[model samples]
Target: MTIAALQTVPQQIETAAIAQVRPKILMVDDRWENLLATEKVLKPLKADIFKAASGNEALSLVLRHRFAIVLLDVQMPEMDGFETATLMQEHESMTGVPIIFVTALSKEEKYASRAAEIGAVDYIFKPINPDILKSKVKVYLDLYVQREQIMRLNATLSQSNEELERFAYICSHDMQEPVRMMNAFAGLLAENAEEAIDEDGRRYLSFILDNARRMQKMINDILTFSRVGREEILLEPVDCEAILRETLSEFEGVIQDSGAEVTYTPLPCVETSSTLVRVLFQNLIGNALKFQNGSQPPLIAVMAEKQGRYWRFSVKDNGIGIENGFRGRIFTIFQRLHRKEDYPGTGIGLSTCRKFIRLCGGEIDFTSAPGQGSTFHFTLPSGEAARPTRSGQQAC
Candidate 1:
């Protein structure tokens, strides 16, 4: 009767239908009687059993269908079970397929060890026990079913995420044109008919233009956020120092005008997406410069230290820090701690930083005290070999 239970009814029915479809199991034996006897034993499990008289036939059948498990015989004509299992493992699609070797050979520890070395999940002696065989086969069958369900769920979730991103991109793209028109027309009215319009009308037009501009910015930010991990990103060796210098160059005017002092140590060369890391640094450094106390100029320090397989980078500033209450909302999209008049931002910078950091296999967080300043820290996966140079300091 509850809403949550009601919503799951359809999914439960669909799962029951999926469960009704029999799982495929392959049995490889030189003897038809053995295969037939095993098939009879597994009948209660309701599996679609396929018999292979040779290893070659088993390999061929494996290529054609996705099997739940393969029961292989040790002694075959040309190719035996060990060789067959090794060959099957070489194929990309047959990598995780559980192979159980059924042999009538001597009960030596070496044979079992050899079977294990060749990727056999279990070794069963000749004259298979009906109950034991059924139990072992059922365990693998249940595992295969669970794995299939997980794969389907992951695929469905991925498709849903792609659709949501596409929706956000399209919605934001369509909204830009109307906002552009509003801003342009309002600007033109204020410029061309300033004398004809009253003071109140001019003020109203200004408000419209300002709001339109803000809306346009918000739309653009949304588009950028949606596109963060949408496409395939190639990882290459990117010099972190070079990325920082380029980001700072873009904010040259702001740094000069604010009289903010910036310094950084030599950064390591990490293997990651250049574009994403640059966005992260740009946002963090830009925020450091933007949020400042009126009494003193901003002092920003960018430093990096190697921690295990990650490079922990910190951006510390001597600007107005975040209050304890607003810390939780600081990294949320469109969540601002201050009024628009105080700090002119769409509140997407830190969120974008978080997104980009996560996309590059990292995390972002900050330590702040109100009126003292904040230090934003993030980690990046160091490449297989992070080429770090001599550490020295540079001021700008």
Candidate 2:
């Protein structure tokens, strides 16, 4: 019979017997007799044996194949066991391979300390007891396999989290744009309606416009929050004063018409995204102006102070203050405390502000009592002064 045919016949016959074979073992020693003795001791376990005459050869074998246990002799010439262990740790695949020192030397304090320092998994003295060696090797091999499996599971979970975040961003962005267009057109239709339109028809049109706008705003806010979690941010020193001035300029017309008086202490410069900080301030100031009591001019004040690593900023408004119970719900999308006729908004401005603050590694909080004034507080990294303010304010 051909040699290949002969090998196949024996392999098929032994398949059932070999199913319970012990894990593979690699032996590295300068002495041929020690290698033979180790093989003989482990023979009863029916494990695959790999032999290396020197430390370098052992490392080479480890690179080419995986072993459950490595029996390394510490007294080998040239590249000693400790050096081999260090080199093994530097290899990505071999770093977790368990090393057991099998030597004839006595277990002295210094040797034990050095073994641990060199990352030996355990030390075994020569004239070894076969039973103890076999049991210890088996325990370590099982542990190594379990640890590798856990690492693989963690890697899989991390990948899944990243994919989910990406999907959320994509879905939110794709859905919100069309919703915004629908709301805009609905508003136009309501504004252009003729006198012949019935009261019920007008009411329905108003409901459609209002609810559609609310839904669109919620989707937009969700998209902003999701993007903050998924996108990498570029942080730099930002001029708070400049951003605030720009935001105020955008609201000049409303401020003029409302007879709102805005005063500010010099704001400290800080490290943040100027665009995001501007959004935060705009929302706070805009809310103050929009919610003023009837026929009363609004008084708004802005201030900042340095506190440890952060700048604490406050925007205080003498407007129709929030109720205590509704303060907590203010930063939630679509959570309006007032009716559409009482106040007009998408109910997303505060929530968007909170999201932007969190993205900049900051926090926003506020306190209010019904019929009293309210103050919104936030913080940003203290690094620089705010951008220069405009010399004077103009009416809206």
What lDDT score belongs to each candidate, Candidate 1 first?
0.85, 0.77
RMSD (CA, angstroms), candidate 1: 6.0
Q: Can you give the TM-score per candidate against the true fold?
A: 0.73, 0.59
Candidate 2 wrong stretches, greater than 4 Å = 1-54, 65-71, 94-102, 116-158, 229-232, 245-265, 279-396
- Give the per-residue lDDT of model 2 (tens digit) for 1-396: 334643454444344323343457889999998899888887765468899999899889878877777888988899988788788778776666788987777788788788888888788787889899878876876675566555555565555545554665677778887888888888788778746579998888888887897677667666765566566766677767677788889899999998889988776567677767877888888888888886678899998876777889999998888888886799986688898788877677787788778878789999888778799999887654334336421111
Evaluated against the true structure, the overall lDDT of model 2 is 0.77
Q: Please give me the total number of clashing residue pairs in predicted model 1.
A: 0
Question: What is candidate 1's lDDT per residue for 124-172, written digit by digit as tens?
Answer: 9988899999999999988888777776666655655566668778889
Which ranges of candidate 1 are over 4 A from the true structure? 1-22, 76-79, 194-200, 227-274, 289-299, 306-311, 318-347, 358-363, 368-373, 380-396
Give the Cα error of residue 260 in candidate 2, in Å.
Answer: 8.9
Q: What is the lDDT of residue 91 in candidate 2?
A: 75
Residue 384 in model 2: lDDT: 48
